[model samples]
Structures are given as structure tokens and as C-alpha cells.
Target: MELDDLDWKILALLQEDGRMTFTELAKRVSLSAPATTERVRRLEAAGVITGYSATVDPQRVGLPIESIVRVRVRSLDTPRFRTNVLVLPQILGADHVTGDDCWLLRVVCRSMVELEQLVEEAQRYGDTTTSLVFSSHVRNRPVDISIFVGIVSR
Candidate 1:
């Protein structure tokens, strides 16, 4: 699992563009295609590279509105609340955080009415405070693994 400079370089390139071909990745990292492929396989085997996925624009797909919902629930209801949230298609992501709110959810909908309906459904499990997003300054950004790698390798 020890990653050298080449491994880090490979990871950085892949993070920037997961769809990059092995030949192109090899060219950038100064390795043969087969060697690069082997390195990537090793990284995957070590669980360093979990999976590859395509990034889609929710707005372009007709789900334009996004909202952040902070949910407060009784301790006994946490598990059931999470299970409910998982099955809800509007919920893009949910996290249990330390605060007045037991959970925070990123939800996307086509309209305000849809957003209201989603919130009402969530209210069955817990109380929710919803905030509509006007614009996102920073969406999903690639993680800078160098910091963690340096700390771990030291």
C-alpha cells in the first residue's frame, strides 16, 4: 500500500480525469501502458481507488433546485430516519453530524412544490429546517490526497 511518487502522480491524473485512457496516463507519468495498468490495479486492490463514476449536472437533468435540510430526531429514531432517507430519491446525500441537528441532507427537486413534499415526508421521521440553495460556489472537488499521504508516510 506504500505509494511512491509515480503512484501519487498516477492518482492525481486519474482524479482529474477518471476516463483518461491507460496509454495517456502512462505518457503523462512516464511509464509504459502495461506498467501503468498494473500500478492502477494494485491501487485498486489496496482499496486506494474505490470506484470510478461519471459526474452529472443535476440542473441539466431537470432537477434544478437544491436544498439543504437539517433534521433533528430523537435518539431512538435515528436508525429508522436514516433508512427512510435512503429510500427517498430526492435525497442526494445525508450525513449524521454533531450539532443540534441529527442529520443533514442534500436534496434536489424540480420545483418548490416538490421540495415541500419531500420535506413533509421527512417530517414524519423528524423535524427539519430547510434552506434552498441559490448558487453553489464550489461543488464536488477532487480530494487533495497529498496531504494525507504525506502524513501517513512520515
Candidate 2:
């Protein structure tokens, strides 16, 4: 879908606050509530707006420790390893990537013992290199849609 300036503005506002009502968004974008709602619905239908979700602080929710686990799996066990990782509650996100490690996982645990246990369970599938996160500088930032305004993709 080709996005205009108004659509970009609507996306920017929605990214900042997903819960914003259509009336409020319409006011900001200088459109009628019905028009804004239709535009948002079209964006969703086009898969530009995937889903809305709340951002929560993992530490505040009692899972304080965060670790990045780089996992190297045997070629034959890759599928089984991915299935195992999906069922592990401590894993927040998993990425299949290049380099030495086939998978990178974002994990959160309540304590060091829990982290150890999680890693031990993961070891059955692959060799893992885990690094504890001290602090995050930036995370979950809104995408800049301005760059794609007039770009044509082949």
C-alpha cells in the first residue's frame, strides 16, 4: 500500500500510543473520525499495522535478569532445538541468524539460579554463549516511515 503524509502521521501517532481513540487521532490528523478509522482499518488490512500490544517493564514484573543467548545447534537438530526454545517460558524473543550462532534468544529470569537452569535445559539442544544485560540504552523505538515515503521497491 502506498502511504501518504496523512497515513504516515497516523502511523506515527498510533506507534506512540496504540490506545488512542479514533476521534483523538482524527483531531490530530485533521480528518473525520470515520475517515481516520477507515484509514487505520486499511493499514491493518494491508499488514502495515500488524498488531497492537502493551509495552511492559520485565524487571517490574519480577523477571529482572535479562540475558542474550547465542545458540549453536547441530545441523540435524535445528528444528527440534527451535521447537524446544519456543516452549521455554524464559525466552522472550528468538532470531535465526548468520555467523557462528544459528539462533539468538532474548531471555528473562527471576534469579541467577533460574537463568542457570534455563541455560542448562538449552544446552541439551546446542552450545550456548550467554551474556547478562546490565542496562538497555534504547529499545522498542518507533519506526521512521518518512524514509519510505516516495521509495519504489522492485
Candidate 3:
């Protein structure tokens, strides 16, 4: 979808806090509340705006250790592996990337023992390399819109 600086501003605002009302968004974007609403609606319709989600702290909910697991899955499509592999609660997320590793997984575990267990579970698929996060450089920040895609508005 073609978006202007105002639209990007709106997205930036929403990314920071999704609960902003149309009135507040209008003031920030320098548009009328109705206009802001229409723009957001159009962005959603065009698929530029996917969805909103709350970023949670894994440490607060019991799991404190976060590990980035590099996995080389024999096959991502294997039903057996997909089923059993996904059942592990420690796994925060899994992604397929183009590189030496077939999958990159995020793991959140309560302790080192659980982290080891999570790695062992993934070992059956392929090699596993775990990187424990000490401090996050970026905290679930919004996508810098200008980088990945171009936007030009009327």
C-alpha cells in the first residue's frame, strides 16, 4: 500500500502503543480523527498493517533464560518432527532462514537444566548452538518502515 509520511507516523505511533484512540492519533499525525481512522482502515485493508500484539517479559512468567538455538532440521515439512518438535514448552519461536542453519529458534527456560533439555530435544533434528541473552539491545521495537519497503504518497 502507498503510504505517506503521515501514514508512517501513524504506524510508528501504533507500534509503540496500539491502544491509542483515533483522536490522539489524529493529533499526532496532523489529520482529522476520521481521516486518521480511514487511513488506518485502508492500511489494514491493503495488508500493510498485519496485527497488534503485546510484548511480554519472559522472565516475569517464570522463564528467565533466553536462548537462541540454531537448528539444521533435516526437513521442516516432516510431520513427525513438526508435531513432536513443537510440543516443547521451552520453545518461544522457530523460524526458517537462508544460511547454514535451516531453523533459528528462540528458547525461554527456567534454568540451565531446562535449557540443556531443550537443546537435547532439538539435537535429534541437527546441530544446536545456544546463545544466552544477557541484555537485549533492542526491546521489541517497531520495524524501521523505510528500510525494507518504499513508501510514496500523494
Candidate with the greatest TM-score versus the true structure: 2
Comparing candidate 1 with candidate 3, which one achieves the higher lDDT?
A: 1
**Model 2 — which ten-residue stretch has the worst lDDT?**
145-154
Cα lDDT tens digits for candidate 3, 1-154: 6677888888888987898999998998789999999999999999988987877899999988998988777774446556777678788787878888877888899999988887887787778788988888876677776663554322
Query: Model 2: residues >4 Å from true position, as ranges?
Result: 149-154
Which candidate number has the best lDDT? 2
lDDT of 2: 0.89
lDDT of 1 by residue, 23-119 (tens): 9999998899999999999999999999899988899999999999998987887777777765799888888899899889999999999999988
Model 3: runs farther than 4 Å from truth? 76-79, 145-154
Model 1 scores worst on lDDT over the 10 consecutive residues at 145-154
What are the clashing pairs of model 1? Answer: none
Badly placed stretches (over 4 Å) of model 1 are 145-154
State which candidate, 1 or 2, has the greater TM-score: 2
Error of 2 at 9 (Å): 1.1
Q: By TM-score, is 1 or 3 better?
A: 1
User: Arrange candidates by TM-score, highest first: which order?
Assistant: 2, 1, 3
TM-scores for all candidates? 0.89, 0.92, 0.83
